[model samples]
Target chain A: MISSPENTAAVNIHRDDIGTRMGIWLFLFTELLLFGGMFFIYSIYRFLHQNEFHLAALELNVIVGTFNTAILLTSSLTIALSIAAIQNDNKKLSVILQIMTLVLGAAFLVNKYFEWMAKINHGIYPGSDLLLSKKPGEILFFGLYYVMTGLHGLHVIIGMVLIAVMLRLTVRNKIDSNNFVRLEAAGLYWHLVDIIWIFLFPLFYLIT
Target chain B: MENMPEQNQKKNNTGYTKYILVWFTLIILTGLTVSLAGMDLGRITVATALLIASIKSSLVLSVFMHLKSEQKAFKVFVLVALFFIVVSFVLLFSDYSSY
Candidate 1:
């Protein structure tokens, strides 16, 4: 299977080569910087409107936020284990763990759905219709809230697609001990999503 | 296949173990951060929470993602990205705090 020109010579290019892997890390690092900018903006606004932000944050359901945090943490563990399984050349185990990770990710989205539903039901939305009957600053806080978490949720969706692609690669025997960079890349993306939530949990749910 | 390096062999086993341990530690840290949030420690709360999050991100980057094992050039790429980010934050916040 290593017969391709990319697989020849002392420097292997069997999908897990240093160059390809570095490319993936470079991609992930760019993603980190992108989200880092958004986070910096959030922090600036939070600092400026600490009282309003905290009051707005208190309107969120801590129960749902905590559950989503736990769910994402478990999913990160599953993805890490999946990568480990691939490195050990355990194909079936890797696939199983990937599917488990996918399930956990979907569960997180579902929990988020209910959380947003609760928020909507309580009238704690953005725009002029926002609840929490406070000041204009408080309404702006919810504006940032919807923008940040909604963008984060969109990232979670993108991460699920990335994981599915990795799973397909695994099923086709394209991933193994000699070539698992894609899985590693996807895992890095998933962990970034988890890290984003780690910040979001405190910013939106616990700041009060 | 017969002449694989011993370091590779050690990496195949111990590396995987270390990743699993990091995962477990992350989960524990998540729970700890959540509980700590309940204490209402004022400004320190967000700072402490973000500090833990940074550590968790570092573990994931270095271990499960194998950033620590990468080439110096690649490490420099990441460091450069982070450096720019910090610079931007500093500039922005300086303008912010002045207002």
Candidate 2:
């Protein structure tokens, strides 16, 4: 019946205890299936109109895409370090690293803001402009582009919130060496975001 | 295996070195991919770029994400996801070619 400082739950619970780990894994599997559906749609559309997809992709900003990829990769590294720090019982370092990761995630979103703005400035909105030579296929391409990348961006926002929660937990000493599963779960989500970008980079920016 | 091995031992291992080296290689590979975009490689350009990106992703998954060290069930989960991804791609391609 030990009481936790931040909550009424037990304080010495093993972070990666079997049940907790299993639950997180289940949630992760659901996430995979969810995104997997979207990827399927993307493949269908891209394969049907390869030329249109490639031409539409050429309109994207490679510099911003590359920068965002690098930013997300660095955030993944920092989150991994945060997990390592917590496992080492370095509470302060863990909190700082978590905050740093959050900041980097936000920075990536900000860059995305400018990138989207640039797209709009070029009159690339869905169903509105025939800026490219592809005609009807361009509309489909932009539709999938917005839906896929928009969903990915929403995940990034959620990841930021998750990290913030873990930061609070670390500050209250609820996420020490013995119980750092939350950080690991959040780290897993962050890495998945990075993985999404790994595919997106080529699909959007490297088109012929 | 209640805990990860000692920090010093883990740090000294070849895997750690390989992870850092892969990160460096990723940076260079990204630059090369973008630079090559200037040249007209036709559709093959996208294929080649994606191939490199996939390789980089595998390195990150195996090392930084610690997929190689995770439990067998977790590994199976990832494999299952990949299996379905392949299935979806195949199905989509078949439908796409019918058009």
Candidate 3:
């Protein structure tokens, strides 16, 4: 059987890097449209209630949002660098960069926690009495705010878990310079998360 | 070792310089957006914010996400997805704008 040409071709065809990558890209497109639908909803609501959206946006801290944006962008850079490091056969550097990406992701979430905490302390969370007492437009604004940012935050956590798995694979030599598509896929996911925040930051925290 | 393909030999040789440069550009864009938010852009405020965000996201898509180096098929798929998204936005907004 080992000598048969049919089995040889079958074995050779078992690994398809391009196919794996294309699969992830397809998954990413679905992710994009998922958030794109939310963005569309946000735009319509903002258009319907421009003044309330503006006023509600002002309640958010621009400084915190900008800082978090910077952190995510930096994480994108670090994850990209990690891919480059792994490609260039610098395993140690790749792992370090992956760790840096995780740290930045954690920092972004930590900032988000504090921001949400501040809002919650002020009784501005979803379905809170203070929020319910607000105008309908204000309620919608905060409602979208919590849903959109909360979903993006969830993606950040998922991306970190994916990266952590890739890190373990790298350590075990399952993903090395010769076969780093897993790491690349993980990086792509992280970048998508960052891209989502890129739009979310402005729509929610800016444009006031 | 036997399963590694020839494509694996053609590793993604992207350097760190490009990533760092993109990172800096993104930071500057973030600063610009924040500062612009303070101005009284009126009706164009959301447009401006969105335009800048689009620019930043494109940069991330091309550089960080490796779309620039990806296959033509990937690019075409992205364009198709984006076209559908644009269609949805235009269709939805047309309804809202139609009185």
| Candidate 1 Cα lDDT to native | 0.78
How high is the TM-score of chain B in model 2?
0.74
- Identify the candidate with maximal lDDT: 3
* Candidate 3 residue pairs that clash: none
Q: In model 1, which runs have C-alpha deviations exceeding 4 angstroms?
A: A1-16, B1-16
Candidate 1: residue A177 lDDT (0-100): 72
- Residues B1-99, candidate 1, lDDT per residue (tens digit)? 324542373264334567668878987887888789889787588889878878887886677666676557877887887788879889888889976
lDDT over C-alpha atoms for residue A191 of model 1: 81
Q: What TM-scores do the predictions have?
A: 0.87, 0.84, 0.93
Please write out the lDDT profile of model 1 over residues A11-80, one tens digit for every residue.
Answer: 4423335556677767777777777877887888777887888777778888888888888878888898
lDDT (Cα, 0-100) at A18 in candidate 3: 78
Task: List the lowest-lDDT window of 10 residues for candidate 2 chain A.
Answer: A8-17
Predicted candidate 3 versus true structure: per-residue lDDT over A19-121, tens digit per residue: 8889999999999889998999998998899889988988999999999999999999998898888888889999999899999999999999999999999
- Mark the 10 consecutive residues where model 3 chain A has the least summed lDDT: A7-16
Q: What are the lDDT figures for the candidates, one per model?
A: 0.78, 0.75, 0.89
How should the candidates be ordered by lDDT, best one leading? 3, 1, 2
- List the candidate 2 regions with Cα displacement exceeding 4 Å: A1-18, A129-134, B1-22
